[model samples]
Target: MKVGLIGFGKTGRAVASVLLESKKVNLQWVLRKSTTLEHRSVPEFLGVHSDEPGLIYSISEFSADELFEKHPVDVIIDFSSADGVDYYAEAATKRGITVISAISAYPDNKLKLLSEIAEKIPVLHSPNITLGINFLMIAAKILKNIAPYTDIEIIEEHFKSKPEVSGTAKKIAQALDLPDESIKTIRAGGIIGVHEIIFGFPYQVVRLRHESISREAFGNGIIFALENLVGKDNGLYTMEDLLLPYFHLNETEQMFIEKNTKPWWRFW
Candidate 1:
């Protein structure tokens, strides 16, 4: 499969690395202008064709029309900022290309509009795409059933470079019918991502946790989503859709919860 990566940053480079290393994927070329000598060397080592200067998109200034008219990529992976991702994603979907976005912290209007469009095309918009987190989402549902009397509180920690609280916390809060204010985010050094759900009562506290020691674990989930994008029906998909077997949700319940319980959407 020919894949185009937008926003060639750390995550984008990682996605390229994972895809190139995999047998089923082909790194067609990147879309952007300003390539350094170091960036130019990336494609050679990855064993894929690099499109630069001659029909290559290098600059970050991609207008929605330009993105729609010029690019013919099958799948576009967006790891760019939330600034203009909605436009890029909308344009990609209108053109029948599946767009998978991994960025977080965006306005609700964008997400609402994205969901509206997704009913027509396949679009993957996930704040945390790590499969482990998805597993947790499913587990949260189970805990809701098994631990009926427990009160849940979420806490998340991330690296110092991270700008905001954990999206996983926010996602978990939404899944369990908790409010946005009920979730907490922490920023610190040397920590990749950590989320803990504390289920408490009068006498005891049960903690369920998941931590990310490296970015590669997150990339594994991205690759998982990309792998499934092929021939998938049009719809808005979350990490819950990408992860399976770990959770005990049936098809009917999964669809109902995904459609209605998206608390992150409440931000809009």
Candidate 2:
């Protein structure tokens, strides 16, 4: 399928490399305005469809209206910053193009805007997209019941170059009802990403961890989302809902867990 990449930064480059290797994706457009140096130095990459050369263009110079008129992209994966993400989302929705955003926004207000726009078109919004972490969500739900009444703490570590703490950790904390202040963030060299949540009672601590040794771990979830979009239409979806089938919890088991589980809101 034809796809568009909105950012050409490190994560975007990684995503492009994977998509190109899979050979299942046709990257139709790369929207970015590089400095004069980058424009001259950016090399031909794998993600750029071999048949479609020079798809990368500066957004600073290219208007959204011009993009819709000149090119048609089925899905747009936006790894751009919050500054232009909202505008791009609105423009993409108006054009009926499905959009996926890896960009994170603040104070909850931007998220509200994103959700509202997503409802108008097929939008996959996620702070983190690694399938391992999605599985962690399932495990967290399971632990919520079996380990209810236990003290919970989460630790997340990412590469030293990462500008912020792990978004995955924050999401887990939110899901598990752990106070925001209790989640610990660590930065270290060469670590792609790692998140461990521990449940502690009087005598034991149950730890559930998801670790990414490389950036390729993100491919599983990205492909899953893409496949889902191929079959479905417009709506906002998260990795949690995408990975639900793999959970395989029986009704009786679910009920039993529910009986002992603490609601996430109570964690604070």
Candidate 3:
């Protein structure tokens, strides 16, 4: 598969490196705003030593009608901002390229755009792209069902510079059907990310947690999405649907998915 990557941040860099190592993927286009002193050249940015000067251009370098005309891609993997998700989704949808997005949280209106794009092409969106974190969510959901009325709270710790509760924790809240205010966030140290859910009952307490040792987990999740995305028809997909095979789901968990899932646009 040919891939055009968006973003060049920590996860984006990780994804680029993994794509270079993949036997099935051709790591092609990467968007750069500028080649000025502020931005590294393609070779330096992607950690490659290519001599070609024609490579690496920002989204502005190509018009929408000319995006695929000059260079083609089978899928677009995005590890950028929410704006990047909408930007690439529009271009990819026009050219029938599958998109796997691991971008940050987006507003409902932007997400609605994603849902519309999914109507014509496969659009896999995940706020938490780490498989372990997603599995943690699945387990947490099961626990939520087992103790439906139990007092539960989630605590997420991230780098002190990070301003909001990490998306993974919010994703956990979604699984547990808890309100946004139910999450407690700790911004301290240089901690990559740590998510733990505490469930308190009159008789006992239960806790489930997952931590990020490295961003390789995110890259692996992206590849997992790529491997499965090809055979799927046009629609939006999430890690919950992607990783269910590895974990055993009880009747309660299965019913929860059936009940909570609906036409995503319907929420708007």
Reference-based TM-score of each model: 0.76, 0.82, 0.83
Query: Residue 262 error for model 2, in Å?
Result: 31
**Ten-residue segment with the worst summed lDDT in candidate 1?**
47-56
| lDDT tens digits by residue: candidate 1, 1-268 | 6667766665666666666666665555565546543235455644555432113355554675675566556777777777546556567767888878787656887778778768878888888777888787788788788877888889998888888667668778888988988787788787878998888977987788999877667568777888877688999887777665444688998999998886876889
Evaluation by lDDT, superior candidate among 2 and 3: 3
Q: After the best TM-score superposition of candidate 1, give how far the Cα of residue 197 lies from its true spot, in angstroms.
A: 1.3
Output the lDDT of residue 163, model 2. Answer: 80
Candidate 2, run of 10 with poorest lDDT: 35-44
- Candidate achieving higher TM-score, 1 or 2: 2
Q: Which order, best to worst by TM-score?
A: 3, 2, 1
lDDT ranking, high to low: 3, 2, 1
CA lDDT of each candidate? 0.72, 0.73, 0.78
Q: Pick the candidate with the highest lDDT.
A: 3
TM-score of 3: 0.83
- Candidate 2, residues 87-135: lDDT per residue as tens digits? 5766787888887776754457777777777778877877788878878
